[model samples]
Target: MTNSENLLEIRDLKVYFEVKGGILKRTVGHVKAVDGVNLSIKRGEILGLVGESGCGKTTVGRALLRLIPATEGTVYFNNQNIFKLKPSELKPLRSQMQLVFQDPYSSLDPRSRVGDIVGEGLRVHGVSNRGERHQRVLEALRMVGLQEHHMRRFPHEFSGGQRQRIGIARALVLNPSFIVCDEPVSALDVSIQSQVLNLLKDLQQTLDLTLLFIAHDMSVVEHLCNRVAVMYLGKIVEVADREELFRNPQHPYTQALMSAIPIADPKIKRQRIILQGDPPSPLNPPPGCRFHTRCQEVIDICSQVIPEQIDLGNQHFCACHRRQPVQEAATS
Candidate 1:
């Protein structure tokens, strides 16, 4: 699709943190949290980012909003390079992009009232008119199935699910076009997860909001996202339509991840692919394919050459030597 079709486009995004050690605490190495990730979110679709823990899913989300600095590459939001924007210039754009943090209990201020918590963005963005801001806050709360009475209460008073609703309301109050939902439902109970997921679905449809839903749960991605991107060791291994990825996972890592999903039907059993060895550390990620250490179908070239992203048609993409071996000349 054209650039006009996408609200956010990430090109070669990389986020690295300095790893300091010893008495002097000088930069010894870098933890490559996000390495050369390329992704796009359409105007009104939920794009799920799934991976194992410590794979840098959260780092990508944070980098998009400039919560954390990127070491390299560009994040184009409405065709504007956000990484190049100055602090003052980025302030207004903050309203257009918001984040729903993973833990609701910790995200909200215990000392503040619910109304104040949800309306904090408005206050920051220069909504000085108390009456107007109050109305907007109430409307936002109502949108998330919260009543006005709940607004006066503190964060400690609400249950985990209600606190999450407050967090969602906080994002909505800003009227953001794009939101990075960082495992919004993972902290809640299974029953509450469904409720919050349904709420997010309804809000996305009603507001035409685009989202980057970060999670490790395959079932949740299937339920809420339009497309799925499988990440490993700070790099995206495969990306495809949600249904397409689930039905035919291209990368070995993705296939292994899919195999772990619980099959509801006890009568039908599916083969499980257990990957050997643990994921390599980001500080010194294995050369070439990061999954080479644990990949079941490893080739000699896999250890020496990093795979290029291959377009398998119909917007499906995979980066694996097994899928299509990289030409030696291309790597040079």
Candidate 2:
């Protein structure tokens, strides 16, 4: 059973990409890619990070695993500060934290056999000998619904869904406690997407894995995640339990995102929120709330001061200056 306690705790994590420019070739400014993101994921829980393109959803996931180093703040994985670990100390931890890349076609090595590709992690981590690694690779492939005979083939030989299965097998071979699935199903056909999603869900339950599933699809998040975070620009504007946020979204940006999701019932129509203007450049994000430029319910205070995340009853959180506590809003 999941401990219901924090498996990963991230506080004020900031990841900035430096942009060198100007006539003198100086570092003029930085792209505030992931600014002060605070979140915690419990053991075996899947936290869905959803947002539009360039919203830093992928950066947050990558930073947590130190694929890209954070500019500031702390990342605690199972109570150990991940940033503090030396190169040698981190080698073993690499096996525990794995990543499933978005593009299956390009992720695997063309020269390597499917079996060798999956077993590479086992070999790197010194988990077993060559014979044992081969066995583990076949087992991982089977877990993802692929036959052992297919292990001899190359990544090019499989369909998109099968390639994704290979990617999943690669991650699972390490027996990771945590996996960052960055838009895992985005490249596949709609039909294949569901198959991959179901496979992930089944694997999560069976392996007791913790996941940070990043995607732009709200429906995908709704189906797979227990809690959802909405990101805009470079900041997380709202986060809450999946059901509660969908039922009562306090942030205007989040509401806009929810409106875009197609409802199954034809009678239950939702007004699509179309925002004017493109998202601000990460090199220079807008002052105060990054979402203020496009928010429908903007106020003067939103432009002057950055809103702190407020708990709006039942664990729902929103970072909007105009937001009232859920109880207060209900009473009024």
**In the order shown, what is each candidate's alpha-carbon RMSD?**
3.1, 2.8
Task: Tell me the tens digit of each residue's lDDT in model 2 across 1-332.
Answer: 22339899888999999888988888888999899999989898899999999999999999989889999999889888899999899888989999999999999999999988998888788866778888899899999999989989998999999999999999999899999999999999999999999999999999999999999999999999999999988888899999998888889988888887777789987788977788899988889988889888888988879999987888888899987766666656
**For candidate 1, lDDT tens digit of each residue in 70-124?**
9998999999999999999999999999999999989999999999999889999
Cα lDDT, model 2, residue 257? 80
Give lDDT per model, in order. Answer: 0.94, 0.91
Q: After superposition, how far is residue 125 of candidate 2 from its true place, in Å?
A: 0.4
List TM-scores for all candidates, in order: 0.96, 0.95
Misplaced by over 4 Å in model 1 are 325-332
Error of 1 at 87 (Å): 0.9
The alpha-carbon lDDT assigned to residue 42 of candidate 2 equals 85
Q: Number of the top candidate by lDDT?
A: 1
Candidate 2 error regions (>4 Å) = 1-4, 263-265, 326-332
Q: Give the TM-score of candidate 1.
A: 0.96
Cα error, candidate 1, residue 295 (Å): 0.5
